[model samples]
Target: MIYSSEHFSISLLQPKDALQLNKLLVSNTERFIRFLPKTLEENTTLESTQYYIKRKIKSAKKRNEFVFIIHDKHSIDIIGMIILKNLDWKIKKGEFAYCIGKRFKGKGLMSKAIKATTNYVIEELGLETLQILSHKTNLSSVNTALGSGFEWQATLKDEFKPLNKAPLDMELFEFSRPDRF
Candidate 1:
């Protein structure tokens, strides 16, 4: 599914995007690690990124997860990525996660992308509820969640432990599909 906004678009990461994703990750290593250390640690090279993308494709084909890459509308550059994961088919629930390149920070691109993806999954994929987990210290992420209509559901104690750091509390935000009928 491709979702287009005024300045950016979100779509599945094609195999051709591996190299660009690698470069983007390398350049934003510091910023990314601040929020997404594990993701950065895994996709440290073009080969690893290709492997990750392949895995995403497999998961997508199986209808287990969906990963979307955010691109600059004009340049088509890879600027960020989002995932709808940990889907529970019986309850129609999924967790969402996302990260943006440092250069793309403060552009409101992620908020737009999040809102678009959340709507797509709920409306098109028949997901009943979506959740976003963000570290309490990450105000930008919290803002993005709230801006995209996700309400604060709870504070999960020690939900995430960043590398070499004490376990940090995480805020759980959720959005439920509105009654349409």
Candidate 2:
């Protein structure tokens, strides 16, 4: 297990999780389309989801990115995903992106998962800096970053552009390995 909480367990996303992963995406279509358009496109069909999982596994093998699935503790149903992407090996920097099915929102799973995963990325993967980027209007995401100990860095202008929408400013929240003063 990569991490566990009272009601969920996180682990490397496996090829066998395609069906449930697709279901999670299908169920959250309305909620995820704005920011997670690309991800949603990947899971729009079971066959596509399977292919996506294979690609993700290969990417993880190359250390280009990492993907974890959040499963319900009881049934092991995939309910969410957390990914470490945009890796910069030269600088030991990476960015985090995550999403949960609408049915599982407001449950603190994301906040806890992000905190635990950040620790794993820094301690085990040797990354020095991790970033959580959110649109300024996303209060819940911003709060998740703050609650997980990320410090507000800056507002990146035109950092994100939702499909069919104007570009948006993104809030940059960073979590870096603390200095040993």
Candidate 3:
């Protein structure tokens, strides 16, 4: 799927995107560590990042999962990525995850990318619901969810624990079919 907004374009990730994706992932390590465990931080080598990209592309082809990279049309720089995974056709549901390069945050790029991705998933893929889970303390993530029309669902206490850190609460949010408008 390919989508374009005024500032960015959202398109299916390609195998050739591995190198750029790896660089972005590594550069944004600090931001990613906010949600992921420290072990993840330590394991984010270029090889591991390449492995992840390959897996995502493969899974997208096999399971109707869609992963897209956000890029500036002019510069063609990768700014972020969004993934719609774990698609359940029977229930028409899927989980959404996204991350923006630290340099691209606060520019409204995320909201635009999400809106474009959600539209494609709902209209093209026929998904009826989308779920987003984030750490409670990640205010930017929570705000992004709400901004994209996801409603507060519930909180799961001590749902995740980063290596050497205390367990953290997770907030669940959902955007139903009707919420698109």
Root-mean-square deviation of every model:
1.6, 1.2, 2.8
Query: What is the Å distance of residue 86 in model 2 from its true position?
Result: 0.5
Stretches off by above 4 angstroms in model 3 are: 36-47, 179-181
Q: TM-score for every candidate vs. truth?
A: 0.94, 0.96, 0.86
Candidate 3 contains a number of clashing pairs equal to 0
Q: Write the per-residue lDDT of candidate 3 for residues 49-95, one digit (tens) a residue.
A: 66776776787778777778998776757888887877899999998
Report clashes for each candidate as comma-separated counts: 0, 0, 0
User: For model 1, what is the alpha-carbon lDDT of residue 8?
Assistant: 85
lDDT by candidate, in order shown? 0.86, 0.89, 0.78
Looking at model 2, report the run of 10 residues with the lowest lDDT sum.
Answer: 172-181
Query: Rank order by TM-score, top first?
Result: 2, 1, 3
Give a tens-digit lDDT track for model 1, residues 16-37.
Answer: 8898788888888987786678
Query: What TM-score does structure 3 among the candidates reach?
Result: 0.86
Q: How close is candidate 1 to the true structure, as a TM-score?
A: 0.94
True-vs-predicted CA distance for residue 151, candidate 2, Å:
1.0
Q: What is the lDDT of candidate 2?
A: 0.89
lDDT leaderboard ranking: 2, 1, 3
